[model samples]
Every structure is written in structure tokens, then in C-alpha cells.
Target: MKKKSLLVYGLSAMCLSFALPGPVAAVSNESCMECHSDDSLERDASTGHLASLFVDIEKFNASVHNFDEESCVGCHNAIEELDWDSDVPHPVDMPNPDCAECHDETVPAWAGSVHAEADITCYDCHNYHAPVQLAGRQTVAMMREAVWGKCHDAGASHDWLPQKEVHFRTGQCTVCHAPEDGSHVIFRLYDVTENRFLSCNEIMTGLQISGSFMANFDTDGDGVISPAEFQDFGEKLRERRFTTDIRAELN
Candidate 1:
């Protein structure tokens, strides 16, 4: 009877094992990087030109999307169905990923933007693998860096505007160029002595502020700097003997 009981237990265990789901084979970024990381990796394009397949792993890892959470298949879903053993691992033309999948809220705004009317795409200005995370003044800086020389000559194009260089430095391109988008004032601490903008770290050190610099200025805790708060901030800078002035620019 004990032998029969043991046999029944063994059969039940076997059935349980069969019922359990097996591990799915999911391709990771590392697997794609094995070949793509190689600088020599290139493929023949339909135009008879050699298109580079190389992906700078270091740059990609540093990008905002490199949280190790999303896989390469997340963007290139077609790659999952490809036969890796084949001589040509990639299709002749792999469609660009639908950025709206993640940026659903942003797509509608972008679609209505002046850039869309000009037929400019997200890929045109942005590098997918190593995109810059634009915040505050970074929006102006990135537009200047990416678009100024490559697409539009800012110096020559804005010749009609007096002190165009100063305007370009202090304001966002979209504020003037894409007026339909609207604009807001961004206050920055400028050092008259250095003739340059003071970074947040520099301001924190100069003011001897321990917590968030913005929070320190936003006295009413309203997230925005009121006129009273701005005046107080200027006083604090004066007290510290820091030759700094808060300059406002339309962004």
C-alpha cells in the first residue's frame, strides 16, 4: 500500500510539472548589442550604400531610455520574428517604432507643432539611441545645437532682429519662430562678473541654501516665484556678496 501511495505521488508531481508554464525566450538589449556594438557592423542599403548598424553601447546606456527595463524588442518588434541564423538578420526596411506608444500625450501636441507642418519628424532632430532629456534651458540649447547650423542658419536668418545673438542666447527658438506654441518667462541667475549664467550648483553654494534652490525661492510653496519671493531672493544674493542678478527670458 505504501508503494502504491508513492507511485501516485510521483504521477501527481509529473502532472504538475507538465501543467506549469515554461520560460519564454525574450531577447535582451545585451543580445542585440553583441553585433550592433561592433563598429564594423554595416549592411548594404537599397541605395547601394553601406548603412552603419553600429550602436554606441556607452551612449545608449547613458540615454534616458537605458533604464534596463525596456528591451530592444520594445522598439523593434519585427526583429523578434526574424530568423537570427540567416545571413541577413534584418529586413530590407524596418519601420520606425511608433513613439506614440509611450509618448501618447506628447504626440498630439507635436503633431500640431510648426515642426510637423514643416514635415520635420522626431527622428530628424532627435537621436533615438542617445536622446537628450530636454529640461528648462535645455530646450533652447538643444534647438540651437541641433537645428541652427544643420538646418537653419540662425545668425543669417534672424538678421532683421537687432542683437539677434543675445536674443538667441537668452530665449528659446520656438518662442519667436513657433509663436503658435506660446511662451513663458524663465528666470535664470546671471553673474555680471563672469558674464555667464550661474548653474544651480553654483547658486546653491553661493546662497548657502541646503535644500532645493527653487523651493527656497518659492516661499509660498506655490511652485512659482511670486514678486515678493523674487525680491527676497535678490536680497539673499546681495547679503551673500554674490554679484548675481536674476534675468527673465521668454521660453
Candidate 2:
């Protein structure tokens, strides 16, 4: 119990730290599209991206905000229109701000939240139009999608992004975060420890033999477990005569 409490506190603190956003980056999706839609933005678009594999343009277009003016560009980062010289193009460091940027009116509940601050971004936790389930609701299909995304997005995601299933399941991604800390970018490393008062062998063996949490304490409520009863339980587990077992013996 003490161990669990500490873990909980540490996690809470960690989460509080990211509940804020760093200064919003200055990258714009609108400016780049001026040159990109020309059908010859880059020689690499064909060979460089497997965008067709992960997300379909047609399906993505169905998102509630797909056509929302700056909204779509915020999430995709890919320039739909641009006037790049092709020889010296600006880098695409920031994609769209995810759904949160465009649909602030809808999910105001999550806007000033730590999830938003951590750069969990709009699409990271939500792919609204399709089968993707929102954070708290996961169906069998959603689980499959999450696992599939785990398998693929794991390699491509930013270093700070969480693209793993275990992190998703345990809610560890937001474990230490609170919605407020994410207003700005901040990194905090925390030291954590787990309780292990009983060894695994002891837990397994005790459970295997007794089938109850009470070893001699009459924990199972059979009624009447005394000093002798406790010792008897201990000795039986230790493989010795109950009376003499507590006296100590073999090295």
C-alpha cells in the first residue's frame, strides 16, 4: 500500500508538469500549399512517402473538419498549396495542430487540458471520422487499430510521442500529466520505485497451496485461527512439523 501510494504521487506530479504548452510554434500549413499542389512539389513525394498506406486521402477527407480552412493543414503538415522553388524549400517541421486547433468549439472540454499540452495533438488521440475511438472508449476494433498503429507508427513518431500499446493500456502516457502543465513545453524526469515485500515465488507458492489470502490467520474465515493455527500454517508451508518448526532448524 505504501508503495502504491508513492507511485501514484510520482505519476501525478509528472503529469502536472506537462499540462502546459510551450510557446506555440510558428509553422503554418497554409503558406506551403501554395506551391505543393502544383503536382510537382517534390520528386520525392512518389518515392518518399507511403502516405497511401497509413492514411487514405479519401477517407481522411471525411473527417468533420477535413475541409475546414487551416484545420486540415494543421494536422497533416503536408502542404496542399505552395510556391516553393523546389530547389530551396522551407522545412515542414510542424503539421496541422491536430483537430484541437480547428474544432476548439467542439471539445472545449479537452482544450486547456494536459493531454492537449503534451502535444498529444488532435489526431494522436482522435481520428474522429473513421473507426478510431476517442481516448476513453475503445472497442475491439479500436484495440486492433491501436495495436496496428503501434506496429507502424512506433517507428515514425516523434521521440516524445507515445506510439506503443502498453503505454496506451496503462494510461501511462498521461499518468503524470495534468491538463494545466501542458500549456508550455517542459521535460521532467522522475525516479520511481515499486513495492516487493513478498517474492514472486512466495506469492505463487502460497496461493498454490492455500488457495486463500489467509495462510494460518484463518483469512478465509473458516473461524478460529490462533497462535498455534498461524504457526501450523507457517510450518506446513515450510515443510516441517508445526510445533518444532518455529524453533528454527536446517541451514
Candidate 3:
């Protein structure tokens, strides 16, 4: 009888750090993309899921690091050679870099955060591969999407959160659940007549507002509201009698 070869696989897992310099880049991104771009390329994760090998090049381009525009080897530092079809087990010692390697500045904030106590990594809330510039509801949407699969099922867990269904749809989990320090309270207009929160689209349709209301708070083009701006915005809402409630946002 011929001896059979045993197959083993290594799972890559690491907490992502921000703004950290990557390892000395050596390989071309093209070489790595050549194989990684294949949709057929997949590996069985220890969690019983088949992970796809496809990486969106467009999104990668938008990524904060863009793999430092150098090589995939910057992050995956253990590959001796690329063998798309080798029976050899993946090098188990592959170095999995952390986000802290680049983003030491945010480490203190993160360390003191509630997430840190729960062992949540930067990658828990942020995407390491497709780091897009997001704002306002976009960030909230991302958090909601992540919470469903990566964290917990909103409907199935913890009394389904305060205000139940209404709150879930109105605000991001972090808006209320994140630590109170450095938090900002944002008020979304509620349509008392309709018994619903007015979406930006609805507000535009109903009131014929010319520009995005999001810009109102993000005045000065800073992408975030200061205390003074927040106060002014609240005054404007009151003047308009928009009828709103506060949603806490971590700063």
C-alpha cells in the first residue's frame, strides 16, 4: 500500500493596527494579485467556512495602506514562494502583523476602551483590506453590518437593545453603546406626524432642501462637528421644530 500524505492548513488571524509601517516590502503586488484575484482560489477556514481568494482591486486601491503600494509580502511575510497548486501545507509560522504596528497613536484610546476589555481588535470595527473613507450614516451602516455577523445578532441578543426595533433602525450600536467619553450627541429629525424618522431623502422630498443635511453639522469641512457647531445645529433644529432625539456618537 502507498503511504498517504496528511493535509494540514493554517488559519491567518491578527488584530489590525492603524498607520503602522509595514514590513520591508519585496514582492510586486501584481505577482500576488495574479493568484489572489482568482475567484476559484479558496481555503477552508477552521470555522467551517470556505473563504474566497478574490480581493477587490478597486477597493484595495482605496485602502488606507494600499499595501503600501509595494507588495503583499508586507503583510504576509512567511511565504517562501507562491505555489497556487502545491500539496505542501501553508507555512504555519506566517507572520500576522497587528494594526498597532502602524497606528500606535490610537493605541491608548483603544486600550482604555470597552472593546479592549473584550479583546476587540481594530479590525473588529474597521476593514483591513478595503478601507474606504466613510462618514455619518455610512459609518453607522458599516457597524450595523459588522455587528450582525461578526459580533452578535441584534434581534436575537440582549433584549434586542433599548428602544428595540425603533432604536436599531434609527442609530448605530456604537452611537449609544460605546464608552461615554469623547461622545457627541446627534439628533435625527423625527416626523411626529408620520411617527417615523425622516431620512435625508425624505427630508429632501418633503422640505425641498437643496443640499445634504449631513453637511450642516459637518460645517467648516472638518468632517466632524465641534461642540459649538453641535449647539448651533441644535438651535437650528429647534427653530425649525423638526422634533428630534439625541443619539450618542463616540468621538
Candidate 4:
């Protein structure tokens, strides 16, 4: 019985080679390192393709998705072409992988948060396909969302940082917050906090970008965590009292 099972497994592996290629060819990411071990392609675009290159593959492969799957692309439909310059043939209007595909309950949970009801779609967090882990969360979002989402168009429902809603309706929180790279995504506000966008910190903090928050609140020109600012920072993080005062505050 053992020999027969081995034969079946071998056949399955052989078949996996076609649907998958490179380190993605074998379930072992070491195989990927054997080829992509080089870092030349690491910083190609504002989009980070090399961030997860050093991740612990054992942990990834041990997950239920790796049992018979030979490649990660089977999951992240984006970048399947292996080219960042080329337009991704990603099918959906929102190419992000839906958590509901595997964990149906994920959507409803986030919907209850300040992001969803305001229509901050899944792409704001999970990113297109790069799954992430933040504050114990397995989010697929970009590294920048940590701060941008706070004063986003969604109002003060959720804040990775803190500021005010003075320009919340204008959908312009990037004036102060800036992503590390020229372009990286973060959640930000929109139509009365009922809608949002995933954009780069650079776009939000354009060279000519100016706002009252800077002159009124920023004691330091550094543009981040100015002490004079963020009085209701709690509101920016959805960490506020949520008291009856909140009903008045939202108004």
C-alpha cells in the first residue's frame, strides 16, 4: 500500500510541474531560492515583489493550501506573467483575492469595522494578492496602510495613526502621511466615509500639497506624529469612547 501511494504522489508531483514553474514548481521554496536567490529583481517597481522572498517557506508550505499545491501563483493570480512592467491580466475590477473565498466570515467581521461600512473595499487591506500579517492580523494589504487608513475618507472609524476629520470629506489625508516608496497603498477616506481608495503615500503628499493640518497642528515640519496634533487621535483609530458623544461627534 505504501509503494502504491508513493507512485500516486509521484505522478501528482509530475503533473504539478506544468501548472507551476521555478521555486513555485516544487512545494519546497528552497527550489525557488536556487533560481530567484538573486536580488536584482527585488526593488524593480514601487510595488514590492521581493518583500516575501525571505519569508519562512516551511510555515507557508505547511499550511493547508500547500499540501498538494505546487505554486503560490495558483493563489495570487496577479504577477502570474512574472513581469511587473507588463499589465497584469488580472480579471476582476478588484483583482484582490477575497477572504471569503477561503474564510467566508472574514468579510462580515471587517464590515462591522469602520472601513467596510464606509465601503473601504478588500483591496485596501489585503492588497492585490500579497498576503500580510500585522498586529496578529493576516491581512493582504501593503506596508503603508498602517498609517494612511487612520484619517482616510472613512472618517475616524479606524486609525493606525491619529489626526482630525477637518479634510476627511475632501479625501486628502496623504498631505501628511507618506509611504516609504514612491508608490505604496493605504486606506483613505471618500464620499462621506462611505467609500475609499488605495493609493500611494507619494500621491497624497505631493510636493505642492498643503493643508491647514500642517500649519494649525504640526509644530514640527517632519509631517508625522506632531505633538500639537492628533487631539482626538482616538477618533482616528476607532479607539474613542464610542459614547453618546460619538453620535454627536460623527454628526
Candidate 5:
């Protein structure tokens, strides 16, 4: 049985290798890295743009999409010929990777977003070569900052909001602006009594005071504590007004 299991595992691994896209399935990343790894391989275009053809293998290996099973050509499949140990002219009009093929699920949502309406693509927020997967508050903050800078300038665009800075800082823009029926409502850290958002330090301190509170509020064990849960949590905080200082948003 053990020998049969081992044989099955080996076959599965071999099939996975064969299933990988592009010539990278056969050619290793080192084949392309020989020339691209050279920082000196730079060119000046007729349009006066200085194009650098260097690729830092160290950073590429550490990227979020980096896997031991794939090579550079896996994403850059347009390169039909490999000129090893010879200087080949870099294609200035080379096409970007077919990210939509792999990210079909997320592509639609992204295409519908306000950023997409303004002609922003995935590469704008997500670095292709060094993509970092962000989550939770960090992701919210990053997106907020990016959108604000690119389009919604507080002084020029959002000057009409009452307490604009406070409103922007207290909660994510999506909390109030995002289509209510579009996505799930995400509960955020707030201070009901103060009518302001709780700082990271305040949240951490509250957790230290009572670690079991989150588990109690999140009855379904889902990451989100729903509006009903928020009301319950608020009431509890109000009841223990002097003792507890943390609360979640109701809307």
C-alpha cells in the first residue's frame, strides 16, 4: 500500500509539471536570468525613454506569486526564442502577461470598481514583479490612500463633507460609499462614546483587557461581526461604560 501511494504521488507531481503553461515548463528561470540579471543591460529609446532590462532574481524569488514549480517564461510566454550567451535586442512593444487567464474571478470585480472606471489597472495597486498580498485594516488603508491621492483629493473633491478629515479617517470610504448590495458589510473598530474610530493601539489595549470579546461577538466564527452583532456589542459597552472602551460599527 505504501509503495502504491508513493507511486501515485510521484505521478501526480509529474502531471502537475506537465500541466504548467509556456516554454517555462521545460526551460528553467536561470536560462532567462543569464541576460536579464545584468543591471548594465539598458537601452535608450527614440522617444527619449531609458529602458532597463534588468531583473533582480532575488526579489523575484521572494515575490508573492513565486513558486518553485514555475519559471520567468511562465509569465512572459511571448518570448518565442531564447538567445543564451548572446545579446538579443529587447522588444520595446512587448505585451504584458495574461493575468486575466489566472485571475478570471477577481478581474470582473476589479473591472467594475471606481478605479477601473478611471482607467486604473491591477498593476497600479498590485506590483507585477513584487506583488504583496494585503489583508484586513492594512489593505483598507492602502486602497483608501491610493484612491484619495489619485482621484478624491480632500481639499478639492471632498471639501463638502462635514468634518471631512475625521469622516475619512474614522472609517473606510467603502463603508459608506460601496454599493450596499454589492459586497459583505465589514465590521470595523470604533469608539461609540467618542464618536470616532479606535486607533490600533486602543484596539490592542482593549484586546489585552478582554481577549474573549471578539469570539463572543462573532457568533458564526466568520471574520465579520454583522450589524446585529454590532448592536449587541454596543449595548454591552454602554452597560459597562466605565470598564469597556471599545466597540464595533453598526453600519
Candidate 6:
């Protein structure tokens, strides 16, 4: 009778082991990249648009969100694991990430903006993986590239503004358009050889700076670029044989 009881206990223990699920390994960015890296990877959205699922790993690495692999899952929580047998790993109705979760301060201001009123979402203008940082000229340039010709014609819409062409080139849309927002002047390097403004990336490459352009320029570490600092930065660029001019614009 004792031997029979031992056998029954062993059987129950075996059953319990089988019933419990083993730990699932946390999803890595590599796992997501396996499929998303494919340029042809696309899905049909409810709006009848073919939404591309392609993620450029290089650009993502360079982006501000390159902190960890979990960054992907942080935003896209629905994709828990990769199912090799299935064509679609995640649920079809997986919701978009709430931008307000991280951008609590910015979202409140954006919510009141004309873009929000027009049903423009953060995803509409901003790329999830390679989001453009809200620096002065770069931010304005990104906004212009995103909406111009697609949603707005600057020339036709801003006929009232003087030197509309120059404004479109040098000025930010938000300064005049978004009057509710405060304005600030940003000094940028204009490349005479390129006949265009030097991007942060270009400036960094030109100066051979290792970290942030702002950090390099803010000599006093005051979090604000003074007139002396701006002049010094321009001088450094000129020393590098870059035929550049400092252009200041309200943004």
C-alpha cells in the first residue's frame, strides 16, 4: 500500500511539472529585425494603405532611442514573441503605442496644436524608430519635408509673408503659424559650397566632435549658447576649411 501511494505521488508531481509553462525568453531587437529588416515586409491597414514594416537597423542605431533592445518592445508591447510557424507573430489588432506615455509634457502642447485638431498623430510626422530630435533648424526642416507637397503648399498658403521663398528656406513654420508657442533664435552654420544649411550630423563630421554638437559648443556648460560661444563655434568650423556662415533664425 505504501509503494502504491509513492507511485501515485510521483505521477501527480510529473503532471504538475507538465501543466506549468516554462519561462519565455524576452524578445530581442534582433528577433524583430529578422522579419522587419526585409524591405518588402508590408501589411494592409484598415484604411486600405499598405503599411511598411521595414526597419532600417543602421538608422535605428543612430537614433536617440538606441539605448536598448527593449526600446522596441517598450513602444510595441503587443509583440511578445516571435512565432516561426506563423506568418504574423502578433495579433492583427495590436494598438499603436501611446506617445503621451513618454512625452507627457510635449503631448499636452501638441494636443492643442492645429496638427492635432486636423487629426495629425505623432506617428504621422515622426518616424518611430528614427525620430528626429527637436533641435531648431533640423526640426523645422523635418516638418517641412514631411508636410510640404503632401499636405501643404507653403508658397500658396503663405502669400502674405514677405520673401516667402526665403522664409520657407530659413524660418520655421511654427514661429508665425503657431503663435501660441514661444520663440527662440537658433544659430546654424550655412555651407556656401553646398548652398545649404549644415545639418547637426554634417557639423559634427566637419568638427570631428565625438558627442552632441550642443555640448561641444556650450563651452561654459550653461545649457545656453552665448554670443561668444556661437562665434567660437563658427571660428572652429572655418578653421576646418568649411566655407560657412552663421545664420540665425527664430524658431
Top model number, TM-score:
1
What's the lDDT of the predicted structure labeled candidate 2?
Answer: 0.45
lDDT of each: 0.76, 0.45, 0.61, 0.43, 0.63, 0.78
Residue pairs with backbone atoms closer than 3 Å in model 3 (clashes): 16-99, 17-98, 17-99, 17-100, 18-103, 19-102, 20-101, 20-102, 20-103
Candidate 4 local lDDT, 76-145, one digit each (tens): 4453333334353222233445556666776766667667778877755543322433442212122335
Which wins on lDDT, candidate 1 or candidate 4?
A: 1
Candidate 4 TM-score, true structure as reference:
0.26
Top lDDT hit: 6
At residue 129, candidate 2 shows an lDDT of 33
Worst 10 residues of 1 by lDDT: 132-141
lDDT of 3 by residue, 1-251 (tens): 12232221111112233345566435577777776677688877666899675777777787766845634665565764655476533463454556666678787779988789998877666766665555455344455664335666666774734567665655556555663434445556676766777776865555445676656566788776767787876676666676665544334
Residue 15's C-alpha lDDT in candidate 3? 27
Candidate 4 lowest-lDDT run of ten:
242-251
Q: If the candidates were sorted by their TM-score against the true structure, best first, what order would they fall in?
A: 1, 6, 5, 3, 2, 4
Task: Kindly list the per-residue Cα lDDT of model 1 for residues 96-143, writing each as its tens digit.
Answer: 777798879878988988779998787677777776555565444457
Q: Candidate 2, residues 1-251: lDDT per residue as tens digits?
A: 99999999999988988896556444453444444444434333434763321333444465444544334345555534443566545444444444544556746766667556775555454554332324553432455464345433533453564444433443322223433323222212121222224443554464365445454357557665555676555655456321221221111
What is the lDDT, from 0 to 100, of the residue 220 in candidate 5? 80
Q: Which pairs of residues clash in candidate 1, taking residues 3 or more apart in a chain or in different chains?
A: none
* Candidate no. 3 TM-score: 0.48
* Model 1 ranges off by over 4 Å: 1-21, 45-49, 81-84, 88-93, 139-141, 146-149, 184-248
Cα error, residue 243 of model 2, in Å, equals 48
Cα lDDT for residue 128, candidate 3: 64
The sequence of per-residue lDDT tens digits that candidate 5 reaches over residues 1-251 is 99999999999999998897644234467767767899988778556988777877777787766754445666777765565535563344667786787789888877888878988787656656656544554323465654335644554566766556655555565665674534333445555556777664565455445456567678788867677887777676555553434433424
Native-structure RMSD, model 2: 24.7
